[model samples]
Target: MENAPLPSKPHYAILDGLRGVAAVLVVIFHLFEAHATSHLDQIINHGYLAVDFFFLLSGFVIGYAYDDRWQKMSIGEFFKRRLVRLQPMVVMGMIVGAAFFYFQASKLFPMIAEVPVWKMLLVMLIGFTLLPLPPSLDIRGWQEMHPLDGPGWSLFFEYVANILYALFVRKFSNTALAVLVFLSACFLIHLTITGPNGDVIGGWSLTPEQLHVGFARVLYPFFAGLLLCRTIKLTRVNNAFLYCSLLILAVFAMPRIGGADRLWLNGLYESFSIIFVFPLIVFLGASGAVKSNFSARVCKFFGDISYPIYITHYPLIYTYTAWVQDNKIPIREAFPVALLVLASSVALAYACLKLYDEPVRRWLQKKLGPAKVYQKA
Candidate 1:
């Protein structure tokens, strides 16, 4: 009976909608990224913060979904559940990236054409496992861990956070967890403030510095989110979905806080947002009820495609970025193409969600032994 499937829980629909919102912002951010020479000039300046927001959401969702099932569920089972949820999309993202690999060759990606088929396939195979490729294996000239799908870096850290939760952090008392969160918050603050970029903008590579950035970025938000789940007293908040969605957009759409000379100021702003604004948003999201059938449907639709869009959109962005760079088209003239890429990415993500991710996950769960009936938070 210990291995029996647990019943799934209801989702926080508003949180799911917010996640979809953030994922969309991340896509727009990446599109703008192709044009910006520096972070300051980037149009959606704080869009990178969306990753941090995701970590927060993940932490909250994981806690809400799993914190109480440990007596009945083994660590191995917990991992299997996570794998079923995440690994399918990871593989799809890598496959999508591999399929688009050759077409992305341009001045922006000089190494794409030089990369051999065998090497590219090898990378794709490695990517299926979500293992971080060392710089030596960087096929696309960018020093991304998963060069095929760059955003897989966050997923990698996400797995690390999960491992820590399963092995150690999940057992920590609220007080202990609070201490850890405090120290992690301090580390996050220091890393963001003192960094050359004056922002929490890295964690894609395998080097010591990037790894430090990644850990700092993941630890605080993820654990803070977990801590919030354990301690939060959710109050009834009216119109939480609407209010939280707008707040998230406003945060991501914010301008760079400080320019080159005052990087610490930007760091402080980021720190404040992660430490305060994000958790508040999560609390509100969780507290708010999905009152209307229309609102419920909207939340469900966004929630359904959120992960698919996030995991799968970057490959398309790579192609779009290449098209812009190869043609030497100005961002102003390239606006139409950018819009097309955005719409196409949305279409592609929804298609993958329906055609591949859901089917593959359903198959995996059935074959993998006792299906853990966890919430789709």
Candidate 2:
């Protein structure tokens, strides 16, 4: 059973739902993060790791879906399929970000409204292509590659991983891939241990240092996940989804293990969690089955909306963060508003999914050619 060949097009239903679960946690974590002064005391301290988990999951899914199909699928076709599945949401996220930009302005961005409409629109235009603009083009104070939409940074890195996979990584032997994972793991460890913040946090900006962080953060888990899918030996596990979900929450919600004084300890924990825990969680998720129709539907709904919610919700978060900053409201007092923001983000994501992303993707697939066999979400 451990070495079983997967069904031709098996759906990793539990993995999909768990991806949604992590996305939701990321929103919660970001909401609470606005209130914290530092990582040491930040609520949902490790939620940043969700991005890494996503990378890992992506690698695993890509390997599972396309590794053997390379015999028939052109690299160009692989790129096209990915663009169809991912680019629609990327465009929507940018549009949402730009539309909400003015609402997010406050003392933090006092000149936001005064900035020329053409400049903002220019940023949004660049955003649609998923390209990172230089700092000179950064209208927002954060120096993000996509100032209009901060999450665009991750998508940029995601594309880098995809290109590497298509052109180079797909050809590696098992030993070579193991070595790649090891080297990436080393870089990750060094980064975590020496990072000024003692965590894997700063990757959104376009600066050289930030790009280094981004690449370092992505390389391991993505490749590791690819390797995991190739070598995974599944086993029976009862209540796998519930257990794995809890495991993920525990890692993300766990307080920073070592304070700033013992930075190595924190670094070790972060590295170990990514290098070991995340892949294990993904494996458990893949092995699990959705045993009930209710569970099946729940998984499908979350899976369907997960990417939409992730890409689009950040604009709403920017608004909420701005409000919290403007009012100087503490999280305790702003609790009700925080709840509203969370609920609204979910509602907005679902709306975008049905109203925009799904339709655009369907149109894209139709125009591009028949869709590939991989699952969309």
Query: How many steric clashes does model 1 contain?
Result: 0
State model 2's lDDT. 0.87
Error of 2 at 5 (Å): 22
Model 2 residue runs over 4 Å out of place are: 1-8
- The lDDT values for all models are 0.92, 0.87
Task: Spell out the clash pairs found in candidate 2.
Answer: none
Residue-wise C-alpha lDDT for candidate 2, range 211-297, written one tens digit per residue: 999999899999999999899898877677898889999999989878878877888898999999999999998888999999898
Clashes of 2: 0
lDDT of 1 by residue, 1-377 (tens): 43688888877988988899889999999999888877899898999999999999999999999999888889998888899999999999999999999989888899998999999999999999999999999999889999999999999999999999999999999999999999999999999899998899999999999999999999999999999999999999999988998998888888888788999999999999999999999999999999999999999888888899999999999998888767778899999989999999899999999999888888987788766564463
Each model's total of backbone clashes: 0, 0
